[model samples]
Target chain A: MPDDSLSRMSLIEISGAIARREVSSMEVVRNNLEQLEEQGESLNCVARLFPEEALADAELADQELSSGNSRGPLHGVPLTHKDMFYRKGKISACGSKICEKYLPSVTATALLKLDQAGALDIGRLNMVEFAYGLTGHNEITGDVQNPLSLNHIPGGSSSGPAAAVGAFLSYGSLGSDTGGSIRFPASCCGLVGIKPTYGRVSRFGAMPLSFSLDHIGPLTRTVTDCALLTQIISGADTNDPTSLNHKKTDYLENIDSGINGIKIGIPATYFDEKVHPEVLREINKSRDVFRSLGANIVEIDLPDNFEVCNSMANIITASEGSSAHAKWLKEKPEDYGSQTRERLMSGLFFSSVDYLDALKLRNVILQEFLQDVFSKVDILHAPVVPIPVPTLAESDIQSNPGFIEYLMLLGHCTRPFDYLGLPAITVPAGQTDNGLPTGFQLVTPPLEEALLFQAARAYEKENSWFFPVLNDN
Target chain B: MSNQWSDFIERNIDVPEVKSALKSAKNHSDIKQNYICLVPFEAEPSGFSKVISTWKLKQEQTEDQNA
Candidate 1:
């Protein structure tokens, strides 16, 4: 295989090749490193690369695989993750000035799972500062540029993860989603990403932005790759039973069962209020693809929280996020980016009662959602972001005059599922008029991720992957 | 949002420390008051997991009945 073709293969495809000995893990790692060294700087998406460690591991993986040893499905596969997952003796800067020199003492449970599954961790990628901001603006590490176009923002906190996986630098990556971190970046970059049901994956040792809302999941080139990665990382983690106690299910068994007669709901309210015309056009096209796939797409009324869940999600994230950064915010406030500082400061002002009330209100919103929406449809389909890929100039919090509204606006569609702790996945809809791709979300009630994969698989089987054609610079 | 929360949220919003996130803080205060009345008296801050488990049980029971 040519170096570029090996780099372009999906996670599942590459792993299968490695299993068959058609390609060696070392060759794959070297191919990935070639791109990581060349295009990585231009895209501005890398936090740190571990070429030495990754190549050494890949050599060992090839040796072991030749001797008939395999760790798991991801064995000998190369991968990367957003900068926040803690790995002892490694600097997890988390795209912030506060932790620029911070060395973690423990490896995150999810990262450990990946290691045990025999995946090579080649690097940590750029992310929102402390995974707090939505758009990929991290002043500490320069802004993560969208791989498709330097002018557009790589929808973030999982910005680099999405960019790398979307650009095929790594077959897949693990990213945390508090609000839309994983899905938004996946949508903007035209990849498949899952923000698993909140408890589906263990969050122990990963950077905590919002303890309740944060979900550690994967972003990949296709639905099968996503299912494969999600299956490996998900299980009840004893160390994080408080947050990660959901039992794991075999995700791939019925993923190709197809969405025959599956009731996929198109929201009649709330979801379409601010969608871009071009994005809506693409969403309609996606609806057509689903219709052809034997899935029943029905217009269903989504339970309206009157933007109550929206504000409450903000409260919980800001409150918990601020609490996590309280000491640093007080003593080294200047270290944080302006937008990151401003957002954390807002968290301090919310009273204890207000925070408690937000938590209480969470269940109220969730129950209403279960009965009013999920009872009618196996999944709900909506646009990931209400607009096309934003230009960095437009989403720049320090420069954009509508920065506050922009922050809230972009997180609008994905925030509900984040706080509701439901399973939501983003699949590429199509490229908009501007040529930047966007995705539509398919959400299921908590713990119903298998259904989401089945539906997304049906759509993807009809639609080819929407990867960007990068010109050789 | 329930209508009975008019008397709530007497917290200080004019404080300069919050001026940076004034819009968000104020929005949270308003929304908190608007929605808190809807939370049943029996709800606890850590009860979210229980709520999901109960919801899942109910869903499974319904599916079993249908089957």
Candidate 2:
């Protein structure tokens, strides 16, 4: 196979090819490392490149596969993760200057799982400083450029993962989403991003930005690839107390099964208003595609408390984030970036009562969403961002005060899921007028990732939505 | 009326943009007035597996298969 073909093959395809000896593992890993060095510099997506380590690992993988010993399903597939996931005896900067030299003695459970599954670790991707900001601007490590257009932000916190995967620099990438980190970037760069139900995946080695809202998941080119990656990383871990205790089940069991009679809900009110006309039109087109696939699209009425839910989510995030950084905020305040420092400091002003009140209201609002929304529909469809992918200057909330509103507006549809701890996935629907990609989000009940994948697969197949390959412009 | 909130922001947070963002997030939500609902004894906080018992996607799928 050609290097370009091998570089862009799905994890499923790569795994099959390696198992059949059609393409050696070394070929796959070497192609990605070369692409990472050549293209990653200009994209500003690579935080650190590990060419020698990766090549040696790939040679080992090729030997193991040739010896008739398959490590796991993802055998010989090359993958990368956000800079925050710790690999033992290595530095995990967490995209901050204070942690520039901070090395963790323990490897994250997700990394261990992927390693056991025979995934080749490429290099750490860049991210927002401490995964706080939604837009892909990292003042310390530099911005992660959009694979589609260098001018726009590659929706952030997981900026590197989205850009790398979108540009075919890696087969798949893991990203952490506190707010809209994963989904926003996936939408911006046209990829499949899944924020698994809170606790569905373990956060053992991943750094916490907001203890209550932080989630770890994958960004891939296709829905089935997302399912495979999620299956590998999810399950209970003792290191993460918040990890859910559940039996392991195959996430890709019915992934290819079409959503023949699935009930997909479209919100009547909260998702429609204030949305850019082009974005809304594309989302409606996705709904039409689902309808044509023999699925029923119903207009579901959500509660009038979205603003309250968003506010409560912000309160909890600020409080928990502030608590997480209390030590560094007090000791090494000067080491922090101005944007992250300011955001963390804002948490100090919120009272414990405010935090607790928001926590309690979280139950009320969740019950409301469950009873009023999820009870009637299997999945709720909404827009990831109300507008098309914005330029770096347009979504720059730090310098532009007007863009501050975009912060809430960008996360308007996604933050509620984080607050509710539900599963949500973003599928690339189509591109906008300016040629940037647009994504439609489908949210499912907790632990129903299988249904989400099945529905998204149906959409992808019906629309024939192939992942767009980024060219050398 | 304004005690340590103003004092803390003035002393610790120096950036005008940071101060403004913080104040906006703090003052805008009004959680105390609107969202603070009295909890019933049977209900747990949302973060504490509040509605997991009611949502059984897996169970329902199994039942449908058996049927």
Candidate 3:
């Protein structure tokens, strides 16, 4: 591939080229690191670059490829992860002031697995402080800007990963989704992000926001890339007690099978309500595209208590988040960002009874979702963020009076999946009237990530809406 | 926010949004609905293992059918 085309290739494409010896791993890694250095500051995406370590690793990968020693599918592929994942003996600041100097003694299982597969990690990407905020604001580090329009906010806590992938700075990024971190940023940046079924991917070394809700997954430019990364990173690990024990298999095997008869559910309630006209228009067109591909779209009413149950997710998130940061909140609250501080402090007010009750209610809500919603549809299609992507100024919670309400509404569509521990994928459905990206989310029951990938791949194949060229207007 | 809650919150952290966020949590229909309800005294806190196991089995069965 040419130099210009090299930067835009997907992970699968790059991996295949490396396998066939078309491009040396050293060439791919050096080009990506150069691009990261060139465009990274403009996007506010990179937290730290691993130039020396990455170059050495890339040279080794090239030598191994030359010697007929391919490590795996991702041989020599250079990628970045949200800064929250720990790499032993290195600082994993987690985009927070309190942990600015905190270093972990052990690496994340996902990172180890990626290394084992011959993937080179060239840098750490930026994220919201403690992965707390939904918007891409980080008072400790600078905010991550949208790659499409630098003025707009990159929907976050996975903001850096999204921006890096959007600008082709890295092949993909590993991100943690507690509420909408992975899905939201993917939607905002027009990338493919999968928040796999909780526990499907072990959360061994990723920083936690909410114990019950945090999910580790990938943000890539294509559904096949998402599948490939998921295949590499998923499975049970004893280190994470909550990790699900399931048979490991190749996720890419049936990803291209298509969703000819897949029953896609369109929520008749909250998903469509209060949505921006352009977002709604794009989602409706996406639905038609699914129809054209021979899939069935069913108008289904989610459980009446769905929205109410969904609200409880915030309670769980707050209480658990506060607990995680309790020591810090007690000692050096002044060190934290105002939004993160306030949200975590609010958890201190909720009684133990409140947390336990929310947990029980979560069980009831999951049951209702599985029986009432999943029973009728193979997948649920909805907007990841209800409104059009907001600009940084518009989403500033401190200045905007309606910020909390806007935040809640933006999270409304994606929160329920997190609450139920289900698998959901966000794909760029279309652009808004202003040319900013908007995405439609496809959700399925737990452990049905294969189905989600199939549907997303079908959509991506028919409509090439992955990364729209940046309009610098 | 209630005086007791406000007093408790202010004792440790004195942010303005603390009171407001607590007030919103109190008023949030979902939180309030769950907070006011009563679970059975003998009902155990569900670990979600069953839900996950059932879903996993179904997924396996689906894959088997496809294969």
True contacts kept of each: 0.68, 0.39, 0.36
Candidate 2 Cα errors over 4 Å, as ranges = A399-403, A466-473, B1-7, B10-18, B28-32, B38-47, B57-66
lDDT of each residue in A1-473, candidate 2, tens digit only: 23788887777888888888898888888788888888999899988877788889888888988889999988887788899999987788988898998789888899999998988887899999999888899778888899889999899889999999989887899999888889989999999999998888999889988878889999999888899899999999998888887676688888778888888999988778968999988999999999999888899999876657666777888789988998888789888877787777768778777887777777777777887887798899999977898898867667455444567788887888888888999999888899898899999887889899889887886764556332211
The number of the candidate with the highest DockQ is: 2
CAPRI class of candidate 2: acceptable
Instruction: Give me the runs in candidate 1 sitting further than 4 Å from their true place.
Output: A399-402, A465-473, B1-18, B62-67
> lDDT tens string, model 3, B1-67?
3644466565735445665666656755445564345444554445576777686698569889999
Q: In candidate 3 chain A, what residue range of length 10 has the lowest lDDT sum?
A: A464-473
Off by over 4 Å in 3: A399-402, A466-473, B1-15, B34-40, B58-67
Distance (Å) between predicted and true CA of A159, model 1? 0.8
Question: Tens digit of lDDT per residue, candidate 3, span A109-220?
Answer: 9999999888998899999999987789888898899999998888899999999998888889999998899999999999999999988999999998998999999999
Q: Could you tell me which residue pairs clash in candidate 3?
A: none
Please state what fraction of the native interface contacts candidate 2 reproduces: 0.39
Kindly report the TM-score of the first chain in candidate 3. Answer: 0.97
lDDT of 1 at A156: 91
C-alpha lDDT of all candidate models, in order: 0.84, 0.83, 0.84
